[model samples]
Target: MSTIEAHDLAAGYGRVQILHDVSLRAAAGEVTCVFGPNGCGKSTLLKAMVGAIRPWSGTVTLDGEDITSLASHETLRRGVALMPQNGGIFPELTVIENLRMGGYILKSRKDLNERIEELLDEFPRLRERRGVNAGSLSGGEQMMVAIARALLLRPQFLLFDEPSAGLSPKLVGDVLKRAAALAERGVGVVMIEQNIREAMQVADRMYVLAAGRNRFEGTPADISDDRELMHLYLGIGKREEGTT
Candidate 1:
């Protein structure tokens, strides 16, 4: 298992800087949730960590080994996976074929097949629709397939960009639960999420972001005790009793 972390990370697209001195950690078997409003650099941090975009300054590490300069392919080879916001399923491909495509990095076909079997068991609906084209599935089901595909690599570090977006309430809970479960199974889980209630539900530690800089960070217990903080940033908890 690996611990993925960023130290004083400052990243952006070209000259448009977004993240500012962001330091966070996601350890194996714990969900470290990044909470923020839109345009606050939550996704930027992930892109930097996964090598999709190079960090202008600071460091990203896997087990303390610097990976900031690695390309996305090289980062994936190191057992790190990022589930994109747009579900990355080939709509024309059957569920099984789509999953096989995800395991392209695997050297052995048998190992890939075995891992697919394990995933199908965990996502039984996938087994039920193994031969169906991914395009035919609902939004929530497609998300499930995308997550299953990411698991094909057996990544030690998994990062997700709002896995619950566009999902129905039930599916939102289901997806977040599975994300937390991955952490429980020894995969370091880092998730950027706007759904505060559900995000906090599965979070072991929470980092609140505002304007691309860290605003607050602590365990869920620490956060739960701060009603003012919750109300201010996340629009949760009670506000003034007689005020609108």
Candidate 2:
């Protein structure tokens, strides 16, 4: 079964619709990328799916049950986690403290501690900086912390928005590698990315959004080879074969 599915979802900031009758799905153990120009409602869709914003219509289902109207915390408890475009970390807290906060919903302290240790091993950067204030970390390091915090919840589906937003090429590569690893470990990943080439490289399937609606859905090869798609979505005039 698909890990998360949205059917004809309509949502927006109070009175102005950003997503219009949108529908999409992310399957278990695969990455489904959502690519679009800025302001096409990619983040908004993530928010809606995670119940950060209530949809005006349609339904969002997780593992076959409708969860469209659940609260954000409620959704998190149901095993859906959203890591927003801006890495959401508590600036005042230490890295380990921030991770502890993500485990607020956990009922078992032992499980939480075990998960934190596992995440620390998986992300050594976080382990090394665990005692430092989260805000002191570099942008890429902060992003890594944000992702690790979300994983502490042991979410079944993860929504990532612009995971490579403001980092050096190397860090962007690192972040995408981590995301790919998450997919490999059986967590469903839905990513909204501005870096089309990197996002497509990690994605098993992709959806192209334009003007607040889905314009195309296909494999990376389908989009990479289509000059019109590159020109229109990414504003690149032309790209050589194997460029992305």
Best by TM-score: 2
Provide the lowest-lDDT 10-residue window in model 1. Answer: 235-244
**TM-score, cand. 2 vs. native:** 0.94
Among residues 3 or more apart in sequence or in different chains, the pairs in candidate 2 whose N, CA or C atoms overlap within 3 Å are none
Per-residue CA lDDT of model 1 for 111-177, tens digit only, reads: 9999999999989999999999999999988998999999989998888988888988888899889
Error of 1 at 50 (Å): 1.2
Best by lDDT: 1
lDDT of 1 at 43: 89
- So what's the TM-score on candidate 1? 0.93
The CA-based lDDT of model 2 is what?
Answer: 0.89
At residue 38, give the lDDT of candidate 2: 88
